[model samples]
Target: MFGDMMGMMGKIKETQQKIEETKKRLDTVLVDEQSNDGLLKVTLTANRQVKTIAIDDSLLEDKEQLEDYLVIVMNKAIEKATAVNEAELSAVTKESMPNIPGMDMFS
Candidate 1:
């Protein structure tokens, strides 16, 4: 029983280390999303924070349309970044517990 407990503890420590490493890696990753035939593009961090946005000068003429497109593009960028972050975190969590059934602690 003691040996089993120790093994479990060891596994937990290893999993914790892996999670930390994954988080660090995620911080350095960026996801890009675009709209309006790529006329508008947004870059976001893994944490869904906007990093940058690029807009074509051609769209500047239509102020209302430009505003609407900016909103849409920003939303899409955030959504895409969130989806990617979820996927990456999920993959790491799953890898750490491959045999656990119905274990969605991360989700």
Candidate 2:
């Protein structure tokens, strides 16, 4: 029993390291989103950090419209980034987890 416990502990530590590495890699994974008419564009990392935003010159003339476009585009980009981040982390965690009875939470 002690040997099994020790192995499990080691596996958990390894999984933690993998998770951290996956997070760092996610920082380089980019997600892009744009307004329906392409008036606004946004690029962000899978870690949800904004990288760039581009807006049409016409949008600058209408403050409200520009704000609306920004909100929509940014939200969409964030949603995509969140999905990518979650999927990558989940895959790393599930793959590294030790197979123990009643510990199938990742399933």
Candidate 3:
């Protein structure tokens, strides 16, 4: 029983290390999305934090139109970031537990 407990603790420590490493790697991942005409752009980190945005000069004339386009591009960038975050997390989890059955349920 004591050996089993020690083994479990070791596994837990290893998993935590893997999670921390994943977080560090994910922090540097940036997801960017642009509008169809390349007039609007948005960027986000894998953790869903907004990093940057750019708009074309042509849209400066209309605040409402620019705001609308900003909303669309922001949402797209966030969605892309979320997808990337999930994929990164899933890969990390898989690496930690390579042979666990039904692990996809958690990811």
Candidate 4:
């Protein structure tokens, strides 16, 4: 029984290490999302920090409209980034434990 417990603990530790490494690797990854019409684009880190934003010159002609479009595009980009982050986290969590009842390890 003790041996089995120790083995389980070791596996838990290994999983923890893998999670940490995945987080570190994710921090360096950037996700790029663009508007459907290609008028705006945004790059965001896996941690959800905005890296860069690109706007087409044509949109500059109308300041108010441009502002509105910017807001819309940025929101879309952020939503996409959030979805991607969630998917990645979910995948990592799933791989770490295939079956564990009442144990929300990633939480």
The most accurate candidate by lDDT is 2
What TM-score does each of the candidates earn? 0.73, 0.94, 0.82, 0.71
Once fitted onto the true fold, the runs of candidate 3 whose alpha carbons sit more than 4 angstroms away are: 98-107
lDDT scores of the candidates, listed in order = 0.79, 0.94, 0.82, 0.78
Query: Model 3: per-residue lDDT, tens digit, 1-107?
Result: 99876775787578778888887887799999999899998888888888888889999999999998998898888888889888877777666653435545645
Residue-wise C-alpha lDDT for candidate 2, range 1-107, written one tens digit per residue: 99999999999999999999999999999999999999999999999999999989999999999999999999999999999999999899889999889988865
Models ranked on TM-score: 2, 3, 1, 4
Assess the local accuracy of residue 47 in candidate 2 as a C-alpha lDDT between 0 and 100: 98
Better of 2 and 4 by TM-score: 2
Q: Extract clashing residue pairs from model 4.
A: none
The TM-score of predicted model 3 comes to 0.82
Q: On residues 1-107, what C-alpha lDDT tens digit does candidate 4 reach at each position?
A: 99877876787787778778777776788888777888888888776889998999998899997888778877876777778777777777777753546777555
Give the RMSD in angstroms, all C-alphas superposed, for model 3: 2.4
Error at 40, model 4, angstroms: 1.4
Q: Better model by TM-score, 1 or 4?
A: 1
The C-alpha stretches of model 2 lying farther than 4 A from their native spots are none
Q: For every model in order, what is the number of clashing pairs? A: 0, 0, 0, 0
Off by over 4 Å in 4: 104-107
Q: Clashing pairs in model 3?
A: none
Error of 2 at 68 (Å): 0.6
